[model samples]
Target chain A: MRAHNLALVLDTVATSADPPSRASVAAATGLTRATVSALVDDLIAGGLLTELDPPPRTGAGRPAAGLALTSAGPAGLGCEINVDYLAACVVDLTGTVRQHLVEHADQRPAAAAAALAALGRLAARARLAAEADGLVMAGAALAVPGLVSAGTVLDAPNLGWRDVDASALLRGVPELADLPVVVDNEANLAALGELRVPGAEQTFLYVSGEIGIGAGLVIDGELYRGVRGWSGEIGHVTIYPDGRPCRCGATGCLEQYAGQEALAAGEPRAAAALGIALSAAVNLLDVPVVVLGGAYATYFDRLRDGIEAELRRRVLTAGLAPVTLRAARLGTNAAVRGAADAVVREVRDDPAAWLRRVG
Target chain B: MRAHNLALVLDTVATSADPPSRASVAAATGLTRATVSALVDDLIAGGLLTELDPPPRTGAGRPAAGLALTSAGPAGLGCEINVDYLAACVVDLTGTVRQHLVEHADQRPAAAAAALAALGRLAARARLAAEADGLVMAGAALAVPGLVSAGTVLDAPNLGWRDVDASALLRGVPELADLPVVVDNEANLAALGELRVPGAEQTFLYVSGEIGIGAGLVIDGELYRGVRGWSGEIGHVTIYPDGRPCRCGATGCLEQYAGQEALAAGEPRAAAALGIALSAAVNLLDVPVVVLGGAYATYFDRLRDGIEAELRRRVLTAGLAPVTLRAARLGTNAAVRGAADAVVREVRDDPAAWLRRVG
Candidate 1:
């Protein structure tokens, strides 16, 4: 009961636009004022929350003391293993990045073990930097471009790895060995990263462009990982029935059109194909919004016109809620940051569990 | 506390294949045996549960009496208003239909008030039958062939109704005035009906073919109602970008090829278009199963070959989990049954709320 109430209080504060007072938290969560005060005190003592001066008011009673999450609190560690680079990040409880590092090294040619070793080195640097800034690393997660289930990379044809245990790869790294480590699909993490934006849509599709395109679905503020945890395989959707051949042995797959390799070569057909495919996705899912991440974010201007033209033509319910396309706010760092955000989310979702461990 | 625990115990009993004993319920829910017994007693006293003979076991010291949901308890009322007819049904607590009635009348040409009046008459008959069978009518829900939100039919193009409050339409019917009523999309309810079958897939797409091809997406056992509660409008997807003009002002829409009218006319292109569209949905969502309902179920043998041929070629991860296509088990009654199930689901999800009212 205490844990549930504590999480309730924390979530109320995190969601408030203006820093919430104990009284407001109680009103929002339906907890008593005294209960809210106790939880707030415990949170402050744990360095997860801090008291702030209330903002100036227009006409009201004395402004109550404001409460906000602390930037120097327990942080989440995130690592990413992509085909072209390895990256790491640390995000504080307030969902702000404090430490980040990236190294461009093509992992496609390297052995799986070598790529894992390089990612571990990057994670150590981020952890050290976070510690120096008085932040406790709560947990770590790795994002990989593959189908991941139970912390194992089931298949990553892009990286030439199959049935590899990603979490086990970091067991020898001292900085990560004692920490709770998780592995997930990169597209899932990138979608989570996009959802971290304040006032984000409740349900939207996040498309992540790379050498191959991928998508992650966020429904009702939660990731919808399908059976076998391989739901968002949008790259293979047939965009053209009798068009170009694809690596997946299918003709005119979406990846062959909208993937980074196609876009990097500055093919106008790539943008046009992306628009047609996205229109189908928009029509089928009825999602009101779509966020473009990875390479798409860098070329939003070049791609938006084509996508909009197709959407205007194909989406049947566009008049109900015009499908809005937006660039990912966090840009290319969304996956690594989303990885860190995933760890912080654990503490936010069940503050009682974290409190129990601490107590 | 008692209400929460009671709900836990009742849910465990309802979901278990064999009626679970108090000890088994305690083990499954992490409640103490005493607490489970006390909650079970409350449920039994409320006429929501029954004590049953324990199943025979190979080795057991003392066989404990098992618990199961009472089939003659409160029943959920479901009413549906379609383009072609109106339907009403009552389902008992054990998910069995106790009373059902269907009226064959073309609603498209009728005035909204007259059609609603006819539906209320049907709902009255079903409620009377349920009460005669020693069952309490808990609540009623209306399913319409259009967009619905907040118990209002937002826009049902087939019926030419817009911005109509369905609950208000039933106010003149004394049998339903005081009873809580809900309105929803027929496709959403149909998908929920399909989910009621034993051993259903965790995540799959349910396609409802009628005048237009509608779809409902189920992910993690819940309907994926997208933003504005209009997620599965698969009918609008462009099947042949240049084939046929549709009412929605789009060319070669799936509805033009796969709607009931087209299929009734024996258009081979209808099955072919359905296959292509289903392929796109299956590939993009990575769902391993697809259940065909409405008109599609009647002609499954004709459509399956075309849909499967397309799936074999388009679904990229078909090798991971073979896509299984099947006819909806409940056939034409899925919508009405699902509407009733929706009402019962409220009780199953929150038995404590019902207990509070009863007490």
Candidate 2:
């Protein structure tokens, strides 16, 4: 009961626009004030929460003490291995990034061990910086630019890696050896990062663009990994049959049309192709929101008009509710941040598990 | 505890290949023999379950008295208003079709009242047959060839229906006046029927073809009705960039290439176009199975070669697990059977509700 109530209080505090007081938490959670106070004490002791000064009141008998998430508390470590770079970051319990680093290096030609070693170095640096800031490192997760299942990279065409154990790659580093390391697709992580944004739509698609195009689906604020965690391969979605050949050996694939290389090279049809493809996605999934990330986010201003025009022409429900297209706020940093946030999500979803181990 | 145990017993009996006795049910559900017996008695009295004679055995100390769903118990009524036909069926607790009827009628040009009136006649015929067989009609659901949400047929292009109050259309019939009717897309119902098949894949796409190509997604054996239930619009997916115009106004759409009219006319490009489109779906969703329904199933033998070749070439997981393509077992009857089974599914998912209503 204590663990459950603690979660409830944490949720109420996390969702409130302003810092909530013990009384407010009790009222919101239907728990007694005494129980809320006891739970808050336990949470504060565990470094997951903190009490704040009373807010300046306009009209009140007495200002209630405010409670909020601790700034320098248990933090999560996140890393991402992309085709052109490796990134790592540390995020606190309040979803704030404390330390981050990105190393740009062409990874496609590098050996799997060498690329993983470089990524490990970046992760270690972030971890050291996080420790210096007086934050306890909780857990770590890695985002890979490919299909991943059970912490193993099944296939990464851009990285030239296949069947590599991603968790094993991180185990070589002593700082992360004891920590649980989860491996998932980078696009999926990016979507999770967007979903965690305050006041973001609960259901939307996050399209990530690099040399290749991929998408991550968030349904009801939870990332949908699909069976076997092999979903979000939108790059291979056929666009124009007999139009352009893709590296995946498919003709007229979306990647051949809307990929970073295609758009950057001044292909006149790139944005239009993206729009036509997105129309199919909207019609098939019935999701009303789409967030462009990575290169797409960076170049969204240039491509927005063409994409919207295509949507207006192809989308069946364009008249009912115009599909909302927006640029991803985090851009290139989203994958790494999402990886770190994924680690934090574990504790947020089940605080009792954290309490069992730490309390 | 009694209500929960009753549901468990019904679930176990429904899933079991052979009739299970009270002892077996107790072991399966972790309930005491007395508890199982008491719940079984209530279910039997409610006419939801019945005792069956033990199967003849060559050697046994004593035979266990078996239990099974009663054939003459409460049943579900299913009706379908398609582009070319009106169908209705009654399915009992055992998942057996107790009564069925079908009438050919082109619904596109017909007035809304006229089409609904014809559908009502088909529903009445099935309800009467079910009553003659001593089966109690539980509920009714109608499958239309279009988008549906909130028990309303929002739009059915082939049928030229928009903002149709389907339940109100059936309310005029005396037999169904008191029965609550559900309205949904035909493809969605077909997918539900496929999901209910014994040993069916947990996640798959069911493609229903007739005049247009519509799809239903079943993820983990439940229909994935999008937020507003406007999913599975596969016909609108673009194929050729500047090809023949579709009724939905998109140029070079899949429906123009692979719809029933195209395939039936022996267009050589139809099967190939279907393959290219399905490849996109497989890559995007990573659902390893695709079930072809309606005309697609009837003509599977002819389209098999082209579809298989495309899947082999385009599916990313072709090296890991080749995407399996199979014909829907229920074929033409899938929608009607699914509509009836859907009503039965409500009770199967919660047999205690049926027990409460009757006992």
Most lDDT-accurate candidate: 2
- CA-lDDT, candidates in order: 0.84, 0.85
The Cα RMSD of model 2 versus the native structure comes to 3.4
- CAPRI accuracy category, model 2: medium
| Each candidate's DockQ | 0.42, 0.60
Per-residue lDDT tens digits for candidate 2, residues B22-106, read: 9999999899999899989988988888899877876967778899989989899999888888899999988999888989867
| lDDT at position B112, candidate 1 | 84
lDDT of 2: 0.85
Q: Write the per-residue lDDT of candidate 2 for residues A108-185, one digit (tens) a residue.
A: 888888888788888998999889988888889898888887888988877778899988977677777878888989
Q: A285 in model 2: Cα distance from truth in Å?
A: 1.3
